[model samples]
Target: MVQQRLFGLIFALVCGLLAFGSVNAGTDGVTAKQAQEAEFELGKRLFTKTAVPACALCHTLRDAGSEGAVGPVLDEIKPDADRVSKALRNGLGNMPAFKTLGEAEIKALARYVSQASGGAGPSGN
Candidate 1:
C-alpha cells in the first residue's frame, strides 16, 4: 500500500510539472525590467554624446534639451520603441540610417526615446 501511494504521488507531481512547463504565455515585453533600465542608461549616454549626431542636432526633443528644426518634432510624433527602432535601423524620409548602432543599441535608443518622449515606460506595456 505504501509503495502504491508513493508511485501515485510521484505521478501527480510529474503531471503538475509537465502541465506548468507546457503552458506558454505571450510576451508582455522584455522579461526583465533591469534590461530596459540598462538600455535607458545606455540610451542617455548615446543621446547626449555626439554618438549619432546628438539627435538634437536636427530633431526637437523638448524634454531632452534638443531644439533642432531640421527633423520632425519628437513630441508630436510620440514615436514608440518599434517605430523608433525601425527608424534607427531603417531610416525614413530625410532621416539618415543608423545601421551602425547594432540591433541592441538601436533598441535601447528607441526605449530611451519612448521614455524621454513622455510616453509610457517599459512597465507600461
Candidate 2:
C-alpha cells in the first residue's frame, strides 16, 4: 500500500510538472507570435512611410494593398527575401541605395515582402 501511494505521488508530481511545462510553452508560443506580428506591422509601416520614398510608392503589392505604378509590381515579381534584402541594401536599377535604414529594419522589410509576395523567406526561412 505504501509503495502504491508513493507511485501515485510520483505520478501526480510528474503530471503537475508536465502541465506546468505545457502552460509555459503555450505562453512562450503566444509571445513569439505576438512579436512576429509586431515585426510584420513595423515592416508594413516602413514600406508605406513617405519619409523614405516608401516601397509602396513604386511597387504594387496585393498584401500591402498598394497600387503604385512607378516601379515594378511586387505581387507579380514575387521577390524572395534575399532579393528584397539585397535590393534594400544595395538598391537596383534606378533605385538608389538606402543606407539610412537599419539592418534590422531591412531584414524585417525583406521578410515582410517575401511572405507577402507568396514566397518563403530568403532561403525558405
Candidate 3:
C-alpha cells in the first residue's frame, strides 16, 4: 500500500510538471505570435506610407488597398519573399533600390508582400 501511494505521488508530481511546462510553452507561443503580428503590421505600414516613394505608389496589393498601375499586380505575380527582398535591396528594372531601409525593415516588407500576395514563400533573414 505504501509503495502504491509513493508511485501515485510520483506520477502526480510528473503530471504537474508537465502541465506547468505546457502552460509555459503556450505562453511562449502566444508571445511569438504577437511579435509576428507586430512585424507584419510594420511591414504593411512601410508598404503603404513609411517607405520613401511608398511601395503602394507602384505596386498594387489588394490587402493594402493600393491600385498602383506601374508595378506588376502582386496578387497575380505572387513573388516569393526572397524575390521581394532581393528587389528591395538591389532594385529591379524600373524600381530603385531601397538602400536606406535597414535589413530588418527589408525583411518585414518582404514578408508582408509575400504573405499578402499568397506567395507562401520562405522567410527572409
- Predicted model with the maximum TM-score: 3
Q: Write the per-residue lDDT of candidate 1 for residues 60-97, one digit (tens) a residue.
A: 88667878889888888878877887778778898888
lDDT of 3: 0.77
How do all the candidates rank in terms of lDDT, highest first?
Answer: 3, 2, 1
lDDT of 2 by residue, 1-125 (tens): 34423433543444345446642536544344544565576568778763177888888999888998888888888888899889988989977777766665676688788788876686744
Q: Candidate 3 — worst ten consecutive residues by lDDT sum?
A: 1-10
Q: After superposition, how far is residue 89 of candidate 2 from its true place, in Å?
A: 0.6
Estimate TM-scores for all models. Answer: 0.64, 0.72, 0.75
Please identify model 1 stretches exceeding 4 Å from their true place: 1-34, 120-125
Residue 46 displacement in candidate 3 (angstroms) = 0.4
In terms of lDDT, the best-performing candidate is: 3
> What overall lDDT, based on C-alpha atoms, would model 1 receive against the true structure?
0.64
Cα displacement (angstroms), candidate 1, residue 35, comes to 3.8
Evaluate model 2: give its TM-score: 0.72
| Of candidates 3 and 1, the better by lDDT | 3
